[model samples]
Target: MQKIDIRTVDVIQYLQPLREGGSLPAIVKADDGFLYVLKFRGAGQGKMALIAEFMGGELARAIGLKVPELVFMNLDESFSKTQPDEEIQDLLKFSVGLNLGLHFLSSAITFDPLVTTVDGLTASKIVLLDSLISNIDRTDKNTNLLYWNKELWVIDNGASFYFHHNWPNWTEHLTRTFPLIKDHVLLKKADQLTEAAVEIKRLLTEDIIRDIVSSIPEDWLQSESETMSPADMKAAYMEYMTTKLSNIDLLVKEAADAR
Candidate 1:
């Protein structure tokens, strides 16, 4: 991720209350003079989102796009420990208190169903990666694209692989899901393609990914596997992750030639 412009952030002091959802999500002020999207280990299994988030955001940053500043916080459990209704607790499985900093940009960048050209390259890269990861969350409605410093940024990668735990057909290639691959004009720019490739290479070799994903804590993943064996989940992760890494190389090769 690009370092935050000093002018945009100062002392991250207090947190402002925002809308509530899976794990009492909030917007927090950061020391760098920016606001961060904060997720607390609230009443549900929200913490699992952090795993996807850190992994996705890290890969995205290595690819040379602008992603929000990320900090793995050790939150004071006192402030965020209020449990939700018992029935609600019984209903969900997620952790809370994951805070992600924002750029506090000057314009509005909506996840509009219509594709725009200004940041199309970055958006295309993100869409392509999401497809590889089976990220079912970045649909037309909640695609977390942002506008900062007159550039496009990708955000909110929490719901990826939500259904992969017991997915019967885990080996299916994910590239088939993207609807705008042909429409994004910026795909021609290919600015961050090589960078993305480097990052993908680093991640596939990292032992942490293999160690952590097995305990993927999403409610669906945790609950669905009790009736069946866990081998398919592992198989699916290997299948798509390898596909994503290979495409990263392909995109990087395209970028090297384009420039």
Candidate 2:
């Protein structure tokens, strides 16, 4: 909090009757500047939800996508709402906590999902990205996508990240393969799933991976350790990345053909 950049911000406020159930509270700056969607530590989904949004959203931005602007802040615990999911709420009712700054789209002005933002090709790219990252979110209907500023903004990555280690444990982990690239947008002349695979292949690095893992807040580490154990999750993630890199050619061709 030394030198400032986004100085135009006013006071951050919360809205009522928030749309989503678990994540309702938002850090809304005055005069429609921005809103930060803070993730809470409920019973079922631990801090992994926060990690997924922060890391995945950052990765998407790094890969040249129009993701919602996010900021990592140590906001007051009052900013987030406790889970109403009876099971989760019951378990964590004793240990109320603050939040992990991974704000979502609260703006009403964002683009329409069909008209302005992404199409098949972009979706396919997202699918490829998810597969490589072992992301269990992104579905045809659920948490699939969002459109803003004529470009799609990706969100709801809780199913990925630290949640991977809980794979056998998380009963809701999605296991569907993706569609072909030709069927996707293809971007007319820019359709190059093959090249993209190769590119995605090259982008992987130990540093990038390390940066991702290290970015997760330490307090988010579970006390029980059985849920989303970082070590196990890290190994699984390593294996997942390796497999994706190895099969880059195959996946790209597969996507292209399916399209």
Off by over 4 Å in 2: 1-12, 20-34, 73-98, 103-114, 117-121, 161-191, 225-239
Which model scores highest in lDDT? 2
What tens digits encode model 2's per-residue C-alpha lDDT throughout 66-118? 66665554433433344455543443342245344434565534334345544
Q: Which stretches of candidate 1 lie over 4 Å from their true place?
A: 1-14, 20-23, 30-34, 43-45, 80-108, 111-116, 163-240, 247-259
With a 3 Å backbone cut-off (N, CA, C), the pairs that clash in candidate 2 are: 37-103, 120-184, 120-185, 121-184, 121-185, 180-259, 181-255, 182-259, 183-259
The C-alpha RMSD of each candidate to the native structure, in angstroms, is: 7.9, 6.4
Task: Report the lDDT tens digits of candidate 1 across residue range 92-190.
Answer: 223323333344444557545455544444544665565445455654445566665666777767766554433555445444343333333344444
Root mean square deviation (Cα) for candidate 1: 7.9
* Model 1 lDDT, residue 131, Cα: 48
TM-scores of all candidate predictions against the true structure: 0.55, 0.65
What is the lDDT for 31 in model 1?
59
lDDT of model number 2? 0.51
